[model samples]
Target: MSTTTAAAAIPAGRTEPDPDRVARGKPLAHLDGVPVYGWRGAPPYLRTKTQLAASRLKVTAEQEAAPLAYVRTRDYGDVPLHDPAAAVKMRPLPSSTKARMAARRTCSQCGKVRPVVLRGRPCSVCRQRAEKAEQRLRARTCAGCGTVRELPYPKHGRCHGCRQEQLEAKRARIDAWLAEVTVCAGEGCTKRRGSKKAARAWLKQHDWLLSPANPNLPDSWNSPGWPRRCTPCQKAHDAEQTRRQAENQARYEREERERRERERREAEERVRWAAAALADPGVVVLDTETTGLHEQARLVELAVVGSSGDVLLDTLLNPGEPVGDASDIHGITDDMVTGAPRFSDVLVHLTALLDRKRVLIYNKWFDIARLRHELELHYRDRAVREAVEEADPAEVAPEVLRERAAAEARLQAAAWLDAMTFEDVMIPYSDWVGEWSEYHGNNRWQPLNGGHRAAGDCHAVLACLRAMAEDVPAASGADEVSGTTVGEGGPWSRCA
Candidate 1:
């Protein structure tokens, strides 16, 4: 709303001159029909609102329109300029004015009136007294003299006399100990300190262990475990300790090397044993593609690959229940296993393959638990009740009987599981892979990367077995058949 134009009040097109600017003899600019003046540019007769207030005068409503103008400055945007003649003196208030002013000048602490008003009530004398008292309270007591004293280093807690006394006592102790100093440790050189103040200074220069400040050895010259030897002896002892430390470190490193070598040899032997086992035709590699892992899982597909890389059995199974959340993992669905054989139907063939043979399963607990769960489901079925019931094992209703059969199936499954001497290839493979785990205190189980499929994992286990048998460096099961993708090109490329 404020503008700064040239000092001339008239515009370029205006023919007429501004009469007010001519009368005042000061340049004035017009803003939206009102006169505008720069800082200190307004005529002396005009005063701002603050100036009017300082003069105890105010412009009334009647003086509003006669000569309205604005003064503009850089600091303040726009100020209303009024004629001093138009302002009236303000009415004074009538309430104990002198008393209030007197109270402000009076110091409340001592009731003394000063020329200027006191700040925050307290007088200088009271403030000084409080500061001095606080300093006195904070001053330390000298430990030896028991007198309060101010010190540059207050933490020392000792005055000049006490500190000097302690220093003299330390010198006395040093002189006494110097008399007892005997053999020097300078390699058959018997040079010893002369029992004098010079000897004490030499001890000080070398930072000798026997000092009055040390609580243990400084009190008596013949104290047990005292360092009675000279500086050379101390240095020699330090050197001997350093040598022992170095020897111990070297021995520890050598033992660590031997331990690592032993572990390496052991891993190699285990791998060799694994390789020989895989080469055996009796060993079968078992793998399963289940709905989920470790809990409430039902297998959608099961597989077994012979040690020679022959596919002994590979079949999809109708898990009866939904495939749960693992459809993306093994790509198994209700549609894929709609007409597949049930676990009960496939049980005989699976048993025949595993029967009395050293069963090799990758992550055996997961697959075996899943198979056992499936057996429980099979026994729980009403159709199997006729077969499960030999002599009415439980005297209960059909439902309860099925439950009892299911319970008994656990023992049967345990016996069935015990019949096969299964070895989890994952543990051996992980050991060969050499990925240790602090949490389990064993080598971490390596991921198969077997494409999450029953057939793929079977090939993965078979490949791992062959690698260990043939002395391959990387024993990861994922590297199928000579570290290449299983069917693409490998030693057992077409065998599967």
Candidate 2:
């Protein structure tokens, strides 16, 4: 059936193609009332476009087979089809078609139209003759400079020498305006012009040139109120500006002195407060075991030992997740902390135990920062949990809560550290041992027993601090002599 009849027979809603039914390489035939044929259903004798071409039955524009219709997501409609024919007769190509193909191989030089072996070039014989003739001509005389020089193969209009001379003459015409003036025409100035181009560039950079029209005339430059001074005058002008800047700096420094003095007094007050608190029996040594060395790592264990060697607070904390690699360092694992209270659960009691007492920490900055981070996470998680519980518990996403909590935790942790101070045992200990430069070999004081675990490290810091306090009077704040002498004999050798 024809395409019009086939399309009319299709259902109204199915006017567009059936995507699933659309296929490639299917045979073209009429079946019952529809026009669709499967590739397997075709006879062995009937062949496709490729099969027909393989047998040398050329199918071109004029000898095309009837088109076959097919359906796709949208109706692709019909495509031209080819089939095998008996007693195949190869027709002659059209004259116009032959002419177009012949034109593609034609050469521009030799007007002789023939089947060219090389597509664009003329016959190789003609190309060889032309190359030979070009090689015979050695040099060409220049028209502009009248210089004769050997050039490349094919002789052309002007030589490189002539071109260069023309370019230089054009540049000279362009620069003719730069040759008239010699020295600065400004009042109280004596600087002479250097190279015309350099002087012009310098004037432009300094904004001394008022107009570009007459650059050679210094009278055309600017002096109006502003410093269009010569080189020497500009140096004097710069010195004046520097002196004024120094005066301004002095005035600013005077204003800042009062504020500096006020800060110094406040710092002294903090120091006195810290010293008095440290003298109390409640003063504690603190340390923590963290997931990793990173600032964001969760705390897995905390231990606080009092100044008199009493353990105040020592606990393993369930860090909400697994106890990370810190388990290796502190010997606290996820299984060990499975029944332990979280940091939040012990926050109130921990705060009460340490309040109003100075804390001595080995590497106070690291411990205090990690402590603040843990506290921030505790508060942030609580906030998220409360919000989720009040709203739809089932709809709450844990990941979303975690992201919001992390941001809040970061901001709160920084603010948390600002409110508290911890005495750093590392500072005073390092001072007593002298700098690493003063200490020879391994004689410099190291952490006692190399204890990284919280309870053990706390004890170590306390021991070091006690040792430092005893040696303070003899050191007089600089113990270089003993520190260097003890060389590899160890920190205790000085006391011995």
Candidate 3:
């Protein structure tokens, strides 16, 4: 058995060279055992120039055994190796430590990490010391009545009760002082003593000398003032005077303009009323047919007969809604009104044509109510609904609902023809017909076609009016005929 002893080696206290210094030197000649180019005089080795040059040409070689090198047939070939100096050096990776180190410095109030310079400083502590100092100084002496009192902050400068009493005493003193001094009698001027002296100096500069003639003159009057009054009072008084003059001028101009407008309006009104009373040259009788007796029912057809008794305008309005039983009488259908403009669209044209024109209908009340109802519905007025509900239906004669609908169709057509009302040119011929019949000892009036058809009914009304106009003749005088019309008879009169 062979025994091996472990020997104790001596420790070398050599330190590693600084990396920054090594980088500043020449290229490395060798790292570990690999051959490389570097500064010859660096680190552990130092050699003469001749020896160092000689070492650059020397190469190391490994010796093989004589028998292996001389083999008759060499099956293995030597491979060229890459230079060790050409290999890249890799840096060691960073450590994966995850612990957090506590900071030495922190804010006093919030315990947050603070910079070294701010460790002991606190804003709240400094503020408290400053406030305490201020409180002490303020309490050292009282501002009012010269009395000393202990109070917090600014209030320490004075005691509350003493301050109040001192203010009252000072006010009384000032009032007594003011009472002894003479003041100018000028408006809003209450200068006294020192202030009066300043005012007198101002008057002297303005070259205004006190008049010996007027002993009771205001101090401001001692100055050569503007033509009106004292300097202080002049500005306000002049401004007021100017304002009043402007207001009076404006009032007069407004009154003149309004008077002219009134005269013009009155003149125009008289002309229009007179023109409307006279018969228009081209008048057309108009009427309508509807789906139902109610005003809510849509217009079915419209008809218009010219003053010459010609059919000027006639058309069917196919209300988008159903016609129901109305179709049996007028023979209109939904397909007929499919492309027609809504009532709202047509209302503008209708209103223009009827502007200031009186409308004639067989039953004026029923036609007016239905037309007004449709207008209100299209316009979407709540007030119209209220008015309709409050209206007396009996007076309007609900019995004439269907007939009135036909009348409205006619009126709409006639308005489209000439933009005139029946009241403007046409009077109720039925009254005259009844009067004629009564004079001939006949009790009954002429019969009106009941069913709602646009063309037929319109023609009937036109014929009645024409026949009456021919028989009665237009009056030359302005006096209105009374006993000759409806609603003019006694309680039991046949005409009523």
Q: Considering every candidate listed, which one attains the maximal TM-score?
A: 1
lDDT per residue for candidate 2 within 104-163, as digits (tens), equals 667657756766644667776688888887554434544445565566422334566665
TM-score of each: 0.48, 0.40, 0.29
The lDDT for every candidate, in the order shown, is 0.70, 0.61, 0.47
What is the per-residue lDDT of model 3 for residues 322-429, given as tens digits with 9 covering 90 to 100? 878877776676777677665566666556545564444555555555565565444433333444576677776644543444555455554444444554212233
Among all candidates shown, the one with the greatest lDDT: 1
lDDT of candidate model 3 versus the reference: 0.47
Q: Compose the digit string of candidate 1's lDDT tens values, residues 63-114.
A: 5554467777778876778878878998885579867887788877778777
Clashes of each: 1, 0, 21
lDDT of 2 at 467: 58
Name model 1 segments beyond 4 Å from true. 1-236, 239-243, 380-406, 435-444, 472-496
lDDT value, candidate 2, whole model: 0.61
The total number of steric clashes, by the backbone 3 Å criterion, in model 3 comes to: 21
State the weakest 10-residue window (summed lDDT) of model 1. 486-495
Residue 395, model 3, lDDT = 72
